[model samples]
Target: MQAMENGGDLPRRIGVYTVERELGAGGMGTVYLARSRGGRAVAVKVARPELAADPHFRARFRAEVEAARRVGGFHTAPVVDADPDAQAPWLATAYIPGPTLAELIERQGTMNKEQLRSLGAALAEALQAVHACGLVHRDLKPGNIIMADDGPRVLDFGIARAVESTRLTATGAAFGTPGYLAPEQAQGDEVGAAADVFALGAVLVAAAGGSAFGTGTPMGLMYRSVHEPADLSALPGELRSLVASCLSKDPAGRPTPETLLGSLGPDPNPSPDPKTLALATADRPHVAPPVPVEPPADHGRVDEPLRRAPAELSRTPRVMILLIAAAAVASALVGGFLALTRHGDDNKGGGPSVTASDSRRATSQASTPPSTPASSRVAAAPKDRVTVVVTAKSGRSWISAKDHNGQILFDGVLDNGETKNFTDKSQITLVLGDASLLQLVVNGKEVPNDFQPGQVERLTYDRSGEMY
Candidate 1:
């Protein structure tokens, strides 16, 4: 049997579902891995008690499940059963196990033309199914998709609408992840299938591979999502035009799902491959990594302002910084279920599995053809150590890593960006904010007076997010 993806902390079962683990958690509820009587493991999402008392909330949740079911396509996670009437209603779907497209990019990164074509085609076909069902998946971020062995599996449908549902909107809330949210949704206008398309555009660019626009910080990404130019700068070649259309400010002008779907089909790998990361210095073995929980701290802690202090890039040790980052990148490659599983085999421990948004990403080359089989799967690979990567494109940017001994381990320049793995040490070299330049600071102190650009240095860190 394939080892669990993100659902490691859940009980053995819940309700009639044999709960295997926690798949992921969201603002409204926690998703668990459970099995049906026929022995199929399912992704079951149960609403939180906070929102369960509201009738409209339950209605919308039910609606999302129904809407997901109506969308007759294999690109989506197949809904097997649901009970919106329960005090805390829940929906269960056949589990498709795999990392998310986001996780895939972090691991494999920026697919070549063939992979892009396949991903675009499969997702477009999925969107066509969604639109045909008279519903819209207001949220279509990379985290919502699994690049399954079968194909791209779209999950978390009804909840977005359920989120937008009037009964649940007593306080006037938003329906989607900020960066991918459409202008209309940002403006609180009536949304339709176009919103999903716009989101799909963002998903495609992200899948094709690019640094996050808003740095995964709430206000900045949301602002950029709404006011910024459709930044497809990271996208290469022919894709830029199509992605731009999906990210267009005007919803009416967006391409129809059918039109987009018609343009996709599998293709062979293309020339000038996207890019390949270096394995590691010949002396060392590739370190396994832990899962990354994208630290969804809140809208307040969004890293935008923190991004403004760009000069700090040179303030810390490159070696320590890179080691920490390598750890994170490695973690992100796991499907987003690591932390929920970390909370460990408990039922009531469901009090909000906290983590950041870019939890996992999955990318794929093949899968089912929009129908037939259901359920997602993953490999039982050994855990990897998340590491720092300094890319070749990172001009003027350098890297530094230091082991717990305060000795510099690895230091170098990332033309764009390069990567390596490290452990959970109190100090580390890291790339700060979203830039390529790395710094060496520990517990908010600069590493050393001699540490300079074009040189390796030592640094430290105590907490996961800061230098020790």
Candidate 2:
């Protein structure tokens, strides 16, 4: 149901709920924050226009919604209402305000060991509940898990399948995110509970550190999932073996959700106190503000003249003094900015590092040049600062460029013909989508690129123009 508004397009109502605002949108549809007639807050996911017109998709959606309703409320958000037959089908669930796991990690960084364990255990339990209802959550990833004040809540079973279904599955379709998809899923094989477990393993790795398979094109990630072992080197020693088991290439070898739950052991971070829990439940927080980037501190040079240099010095050659002062100020600003952008500082030496000890191993990689080739290396310049420029040539691409300090210099889509520049003193990491569509220039030298469209690529560079 759509209620007309006075001006531009606005959906005042959807079914019985009054639309408040859009929470988010995805391939399937947009989810709106709405209030029921009874004054209860809810999240209403309205199907996309095209999806609503597809009878097959509507049937699947309706079945999934019914299954979602059957999911136990213990570790999952319960479906409150839905209307699949409506003009634009929609489903509503109790609104819980919190950041999704993906959002949390992006803003607050990776979770501690105990936090990761809690997350894994909670998700496994949720899957157990979901599976007990004879449903397999075919799509389980960080974006689908909400870190509520009470505990983690699993969400979005939009593509869940009933265990007893005999219809041919659409395994070949690129339905889920690449890195998180199971090997079987990537191969277009029948996905079962083990598939969810595989996704769980990927999620745990992402929560604890970063993507286990690393970033690449979806097809590349899929190939890795089918052929290579998960990289759990970043996981704590205590969890390596267990997480490894969950990521086993063979479905039969993977642990069931119930077994995985037991393996998580005791909660490392216990629940809040009764009073705290009461308060949390009584008045829930709606959203968590993104972590703020620390702005560069003022060097106080902007007012240095007022503090130092006596008034009598003002009689000196004004132009000469001004030129000298300006040069000094410029040099100081550039150096400070470079130092602040160094990535390894705030990490306190915790992340992957390209140290002297690993230089031999790094150089041994045949595909990646340990150092810029003599033919490709940038000519020696006056300053040692590293510089990078990316120009989108034929197609739009997504980009995330970060300095050593983990500060995002740019993170968004880049349209064709657009260009972006970045600089850093120590190192910079770039995550690029459709790498083939962009030309890369490092320190004024162009690097050879044969990347293809729709592929993801991650590149790290140091001040010396060395690739890591």
Q: Against the true structure, candidate 1 has what lDDT?
A: 0.53
Candidates' lDDT values, in order? 0.53, 0.64
RMSD of each: 23.2, 18.6
After TM-score superposition, the amount by which residue 430's alpha carbon in candidate 2 deviates from its true location, in angstroms, is 32
Q: On residues 1-468, what C-alpha lDDT tens digit does candidate 1 reach at each position?
A: 222355654455555887767778765578888888888889888876756777777777777777778767879887788888876688888889899887888898688656777787788888777778777878788888898998888887647777654322211233467677774564344577778888888887677655335464333454345434555655665566677777765665578777776655543333422232224333444643333333221122223422443333223211111121122455333111100011101112121221321132111112112222111111111223212222232333333344444333433233222333333334344322123144232222333323222221122344443432
- Give residue 36's lDDT in candidate 2 (0 to 100): 89
**Candidate 2's residue-wise lDDT over 1-468, tens digit each?**
775667545578999899988888754568889998889999898876756666766777778888778888577889999998999888899998899999999999988768888888899999988888877787788888888999999887645342112111222122466677775454333467777898999999898865667665553465445435677766766677788888876676678888987878686555456676667666656743334343332111112111223332233111111111222544332111010011111222122322322222211001112233422433443257877777676755555567776555654445555566677788777755456778787877787876544655557788877775
Q: Write down the TM-score of every candidate.
A: 0.55, 0.56
CA lDDT of 341 in candidate 1?
10
Q: Model 1 off-target regions past 4 Å?
A: 1-12, 166-173, 266-468
